[model samples]
Target: MSDIGISTKAMGKSGVTFSPLKVLKGFIPKLDTKAIVKNALISLASILLFVLLWHLGANYLFNIEATAKIEKARTEQGAEAAAQMEACILSGDVSCQPNTLPSPQQVIVAAQNLWADHLSISAKKTAFKAKVATTNADRKAQGLKPIKYTGRPSFIDQILTSIKTVFAGFLLAMFIAIPIGIITGLNENLKTAFNWLIQIFKPVSPVVWLLLVFMIVKTLIRDPELDKSFIIAAISVGLCAMWATLVNTSLGVSSVKTDYMNVAKVLQLSLGKKIFKIIIPSSIPLIFTGLRITVSVAWMVLIAIELLAQSPGLGSFVWEEFQNGANDSNAKIIVAMFVIGIIGFLLDRVMLFVQQSVSFETQ
Candidate 1:
């Protein structure tokens, strides 16, 4: 009887319990599995909005023909202005002719000229100056003659150059970072002292660093070879990457658990073995994470360095394309932008895979 009474009371209590989730689950719709889906949709909407606004703004601000047409139409403003407004709306720009952002058709035409056509005598006249500073939408390509890419190499060549430079810098960073980091890890005083310097330089801007390097090279190496600019850029990038590896590696090495340190001491483990077997293996994750970050930062620096140094890397290629005062040059620049993004992503993925593969697996 007592058991039955207790069960009845528990059931009565359960009925009184308020659970919004339970009530909502029964009454409301199921929550979305992918919050990213909605976020992505929103992000896409924002991008479209930005693109639309930018197109309208650029066309309204700079498209002389379109502006002329608009002024004419507005001057003729009468009862029919509202009705005629629809005729002016074309592609992304306000125009007597239809278009805001250049249509794909226009850009495609422009892109072909950049990739294939030779420079014209007219282009040669304007080549030395920066006067062709038109926005992408304004310079949308039209007609049959395409723009030329005439990249120092080619698109593939530029991609390869940038990748090679980044890899070289990253590899050099790893090599230099390890031995020094290990030494610093073994010495408390050295580690603490250099850590301060590393912090200072790590946060310093790469652009400033490049200018400093440029000045140093100019002062020291009289008559710098433009061809060797890429090499110089890579070295600068590697140097910039040095601190992260040093700090992470030192922290990782010094952080081997106390128990492990004591075990090594008790066993009288050789210093070499202790470092190789215990310290490095234990700190693998931290060390690799630093390397990953270093490489990504190096890639960014590589592009910036290339841009400033006029090096034969992706950055220079992008700058060159942007400067090209041809119809399809903007398209080429856009393509280069995508190429840089893809390459950067791939480099990151490669490091991530390396981290995943190299980490010690628990039995």
Candidate 2:
């Protein structure tokens, strides 16, 4: 018999080992990294599949019923259009007509057209700028057509406005929130005073705060010095969303092991040295985490801010898309939606890279 068939007289000192691949699914605990990764990958795939299924279902479900409803609506609208034309011929002024919504296909095409036009215009402007930078005859040489991105409503403009708002607000939030967080974490008295404020503001509804901010900024600030509309919108959004970071940073710093604090004291380190060398390093993980959350919150709140009474960013873009009734507006709407998602994801990844670069490494 082969060695495998023979009874083992003694097990190896290291003991019998089995490959994870040899085990069935669910034969491991939650703490098992191999199993966890495997399961997570599977779950991710499942989620993607579910999302795809949901999209398709949302697009078309129980085909006959959808077709029936669409056909009925189309017929009614066609009849109304004929009546409107008849009335126009008979009467000098024709105002009565059916408020017909565009089909999904029409909306998609419009959205695509908007995206193309936007890219073309953006490219032209870029090329113009480049040529102007290097040569005096750049304008004459650079003969790019003036292709506008949208029709009466400019979705591209709205998106750009939103992006500007997000970046500015996010930066401002970080500036104020981070410093205060550090101060609170470093000093007991400061922490005691600031903790209540953080707690109260953290869960405050973003909409309420934004409305209040809009009122305050618009009423108090002059439009000449600052664009109150956009600036207040951005600031309100940023302020509402950044409390988590402030609180997290303070908590992270406070929770750093007592041993490290003691070591810093023993070394007779200056306050700045203690902060930069000891305290900061210890709380990097938490700070980065908080930053990530804050930025994401800022990004998400952007749409809400824009969609509200006077949203400036992608919110306005989407609003216009919806207002267009899904015909000549769909494609631009889709493109704007994509731009928002891509920008948010990219921004978060950039922050992650920054965190990794600044953070201490452990082998």
Candidate 3:
């Protein structure tokens, strides 16, 4: 009995237990299964409701257009033409189908077609790369440019391009806004002087920014190989989006606690140290908030800027589809719309996560 008690105490010290119930508890995680089930069911129901509403709306518009077509045929070409038009529509001929809002099924089909196009494009790119590998190597030896793929970008490629453009714009906004904001925030007179400029530019339209950027980029970027449209779009997006970050950063820095500043002064911290250690740390939450807003604004303006600049991105995709007016064009546009919204939501969430990770208040 004395030896068993000693062994039990030793096991306790080592955090080793030998009970069936305790082992079972350790292996089984505690979870609120009911809550999980309830949330899943609610989400399912919501999605179903949205799909149902979309179906109804699409069907209503489709019927109205179809009825008008039939009526026009009857008025001009008599009962036989009207009957033929009705039969054509009933037979689900693409030519006779109403070019209105597409149902969910049509959107799904569009999405699948886009995916197939992406795959086909990817295969072609791979083949092109393989075919040019030897020629590219010889060109490098001869000091000439290698052959490049000149095919149009697929849907996925456009999405990636748009994402890249937005990120470039966001970086530009951060770099420009933060330094100016800090300088303005540090000096009362500077803030007062710059207030008018900030206020004036903050409400400027994205189209105006794009035009301004286009004029400058066209003059500055004379290289035929350089992507002038991308530069203009990125710069315009940056200019349009930076105001939010600039304003928020200024507010955050100016609003830093006096107590922290006093401590920094008491410690004889240098200007750089004071700004980095005291001001920046205190202003992180608000600065991140501003950054999040800036990202959102950048993404929002990017579409318009891309459209104006003729950048090969979602905006261009949307414009091209609208002009094409194919049977699947509307569905494709809707798919792009959903993709844009989802990406925007994800970007905001990512920013929020980063903000929470870095900010003490959020933590």
Best by lDDT: 3
Give the per-residue Cα lDDT of candidate 2 at 206.
75
- Give me the displacement of residue 116 in model 3, in angstroms: 0.6
Clash tally, candidates in order? 10, 6, 0
| Model 3 ranges with Cα > 4 A deviation | 1-30
Cα TM-score per model: 0.63, 0.65, 0.92
lDDT of candidate 1 over 306-337, digit per residue (tens) = 88878786798779877764444555666666
The candidate maximizing TM-score is: 3
Report every candidate's CA lDDT: 0.72, 0.70, 0.93
lDDT of 2 by residue, 1-363 (tens): 355323232233346554344343334444878888999999999978865675565455424433554456558777665555555434533242222333344445666777677687777767766655545454346774433233333457666787788888888888888888889998999999987888777888878878889778777886574566687778877797678678878887778888998998899899899898988789888888888888888888888777774655688767866786543454456556667898889889988887777677671
**Which residue pairs overlap in candidate 1's backbone?**
92-100, 93-99, 93-100, 110-328, 113-146, 113-147, 113-148, 114-147, 114-148, 114-149
Q: Residue 24 lDDT in model 3?
A: 57
Q: How does model 3 score by TM-score? A: 0.92
